[model samples]
Target: MCRWLAYSGEPLRASAVLLDATHSLVAQSLDSPMGAETVNGDGFGVGWYPEGAVAGSIPAVFHSVEPAWNDENVRELSRSIESPLFFSHVRAAAGPPIQRTNCHPFRWENWLFMHNGFLAEFAKVKRDLTFAIDPSLYPHVTGTTDSEVLFHLAITHGLADDPVAALTAAVDQVERVGRDQGVLFPMQGTIAVTDGATIWALRYSSQGRSRTLFHSRDVPTIREMYPEAERLSQFGDHAQLVVSEPLNDLPGLFIEVPESTIAILDREGYHHEPFRSAA
Candidate 1:
């Protein structure tokens, strides 16, 4: 899979979250303690809103086939851009080639999406699922991985309606077909989808034991806990983060997203509810 973090709240430099944290996303590229692979250096990407872009406009994107630790562009861009919402991902190739098209922060208009797990035995179900894609979205399916396909499937099914239900249908479609082909544990992921403000992070898997997904506790709580932590002062009261793992080991810094749950984070604090998988 991969390691990624999605954040939204008061606008701040993207680098502050991705590069400056003690256990920053860049550091995770070299030493991601929580993922199955300690190092996710295959490729990386970052997407964030522009300072004056209209609501839901395409956020700027930077992707590299090089390891994140070795990429200068990411470092420069992260340090310069300020966004209220952004996504950064460092990948460990899970059966796909290292190419820009395969990199994450996949987009459809104002929405941005990233995935950090796999569809077990993808090769077995590739053709069937590809043909199943809606003709309207088939051309936009530029990547071969099941992750991108899942994103488009969600779009095709209706991301504009109910994102949770659309994603549920996408997973159900994958699992339903996988079962017919004798593929076990057909889906697993920690996905982030956002429209600048609200973020929908869903964590689930057929066999459970899905990859780790966590979100920071409210900024006020964290500030009170570590009054000396310099970074806490930069954030607003509603600031929050949804990450693949704890960015740092501060006590009560992050809360584990429960199994089969969709965590909704916006200007408000955070809310978790059991995900009703709909397919």
Candidate 2:
């Protein structure tokens, strides 16, 4: 398993959450209390839409096959860049080889996708799953990880038109294929996807117990709860975050997203709904 986070709201330096927090994504990479693996040092990646990006503009990505905590470039770049929406992920390479191409926040056109879970027995169903991708999109499948294939599968299933539906379909395909091959638990993990404007985060697993996930409570709500917490002043009323785990120990600061649920964040704020795959 890996760890990831998605941010959507006011423009802010990526480092604010990726490095500056008490349990920032970088910190989680070094020592994650809730992750299946404590150290996710295989590699890391960041994808962000520039602060003033025009509509339909694609996000930029920086990937490195280096432990995030040891990568000087991760700190430098994150501090310099401000984005209204972004994604950061640290990998633990369950079975795939560590390489730049295998990093998270995989991009296609204006959309970015990242996963914190895996498809069980991927090798058994890798061929079937890969072949199921549309030929036009299949060529872009440059990595061997199941995460990348899952992203493309979502695109093939209509991610651009309807992300929640597309993701459900993608999971269904993976489970159907895996079960056919005799894997009882075909899928397990949390996923986040964004198109520079809206973010959709999902927590699900074939066994009904997915990895942990949480979204920040609205900024105004947090400020009201802790009137003297000056740190909360930096955020605007609309600022929100969905992460693999809470960034800090501040009580009521984060709300755990329910299992088998999809959390959607946009200008309207977070909305969650039950998520189920046909399989």
Candidate 3:
């Protein structure tokens, strides 16, 4: 499994979440208290939309094989760029080799996607699953990770038009293919995807248990609850984050996204709905 987080709302330096937070992404990479793996040092990546991006602009991605804490480029980029939407992930390989292409925050057009967890016995269903992807999208899937494959599957199912429905359909196909291959549990993981305007996060597992997923409570609520925390001032009212683990120990600041649920974050606020199984 891996650790990841997505940020949306007012434009601020990516470091606000990747570095400045008490238990930042870099900190989580080294010692995650809630992840499936404690050390997510296999590799890391960050994707962010640049300022003035239009609807179809693809976010820039920076991936490296080095551990997040040790990578100077990650440090430099995080501290330099300011974006309203971005994604950061630190990986602990479950099966795929640690390489740049296999890093999280995979991008396609205006979308950015990342996942934490693995497809149970992926090798058993790889052929069947890969062949199910849209023929046109097959050429665009440049990586060899189940997470990246899942992204293309979602796109193939229409993520560009309706993310929730498309992802649900994609998961159903994965589970069906897994069962056909005799695998007991077909899919597992939490997924986060965004279009630089809205964000959607899902927590689910075929076996009925999934990795941790949490989103920050409304910033104003948190500010009122912990007025002494000076760092909270840096974020705008709409700023929000959905992470694999809480960025800090604050009790009321983050809420766990329930298993088999989808959490949506937009200009209005964060709301969650039970995930419907397409299978």
Worst 10-residue lDDT window for candidate 3 reads: 270-279
- lDDT for predicted candidate 2 compared with the true structure: 0.93
Best of the two (1, 3) by lDDT: 3
From the highest TM-score down, the ranking of the candidates is 2, 3, 1
Stretches > 4 Å off in candidate 3: none
- Using all chains and alpha carbons, the TM-scores for the candidates as numbered come to 0.97, 0.99, 0.98
Q: What lDDT does candidate 2 reach at residue 261?
A: 97
Candidate 2 residue pairs in backbone clash? none
- lDDT order of candidates, best first? 2, 3, 1
Worst 10 residues of 2 by lDDT: 229-238
Q: Rate the local accuracy (lDDT) of all candidates.
A: 0.87, 0.93, 0.91
Q: Which one wins on TM-score?
A: 2
Q: Total clashes, candidate 2?
A: 0
